[model samples]
Target: MSPFKGKTGFKRILNAGGYSLDGLRAAFTGEAAFRQLVLLNVILIPLSFFLNVSRVERALLIAVCLLALIVELLNSAIEAVVDRISLDLHPLSKNAKDMGSAAQFVVLTMIAVVWALILL
Candidate 1:
């Protein structure tokens, strides 16, 4: 057993927060897709605040934007894990990567559709 696994209580929570920060740093630095999504969020999230939308519309707009970021994070993680397993050309690896890309695409489309419906 590892000593790291035995952590609990506040210490565990603190370590987990640190780990999450590290993951974000890694994603921002290493993944161009993640950075691009982050850039999109930077633009859209604040734009949501400025829009003449109802509270619910604003919230939905922000929610979908955040969802895109979440999906991108998951996608980046999946690609990293797949690459770590093997860089060799494999069908399953390609499928996994493609699926992640597809998920991001869907989220981005959702953001556009939601904003369009609310604004126009």
Candidate 2:
């Protein structure tokens, strides 16, 4: 048997919801960009209520923010998996990270456009 198979308890925990929780925990704990986004969302969501915004506008704002968070999480996952394979400055790894960053930027731009149309 493999040495990793010895921990039956860990196996059971992994089979439960631990894996999902662990991913969220890692995002908050390890990803700086995610942490910043969450902070901004915390402020923005509440401020939207007091902004005299319409329901549709509020929904759009929230949707865009959630999309940003989703993109950030995916990017963080990609970076983590790439780092897991190797930490060296490989070209493909750099491309992967760059592409993930680009995706986040696109989402951020969408969010900005949506909010600008609503607020300005």
Candidate 3:
């Protein structure tokens, strides 16, 4: 079994929360793309509320924006793990990182489509 796998209950929840916050802090500090998306979220999330849309539409807008952040975090995690394994310019490592980037790009495109449909 994996060494990182076995925590349960309230203690697990607390530990998980701490780990998640640390991941966010690491991503915010280490990834410029993450920082840019976060700044966009800071403006867009609140602006989403004030737009003349139904509650469901507002939620969809906000959710898609947040999804971009989620994808970015996952991408960052993938890159980090790949780098941790080796910094060498291996083809597989490059492919893994590229796939993560493509995932983020797709999510960003989805966010744009959702926002345009709801707001315009």
Cα lDDT tens digits, model 2, 8-113, are 6767677556777888799999989999999989987888888888898898888888898899999999998999999999999999999999999999999889
Q: On residues 72-105, what C-alpha lDDT tens digit does candidate 3 reach at each position?
A: 9999999999999999999999999999999998
Q: lDDT of candidate 3 vs native?
A: 0.93
Cα-lDDT of candidate 2: 0.89
- Count of clashing pairs, candidate 3: 0
The number of clashing residue pairs in each candidate reads 0, 0, 0
Best by TM-score: 1
Q: List the RMSD of every prediction in angstroms.
A: 1.4, 4.4, 1.3
Query: What residue runs in model 3 are displaced by over 4 Å at the alpha carbon?
Result: 2-6
**C-alpha positional error of residue 55 in candidate 3 after TM-score superposition, expressed in Å:** 0.6
Model 1 CA RMSD to the hidden true structure, in angstroms: 1.4
CA lDDT of each prediction against the hidden true structure: 0.93, 0.89, 0.93
TM-score of each: 0.94, 0.82, 0.93
Clash pairs (backbone) in predicted model 1: none
Ranking by TM-score: 1, 3, 2
Winner on TM-score between 1 and 2 is 1
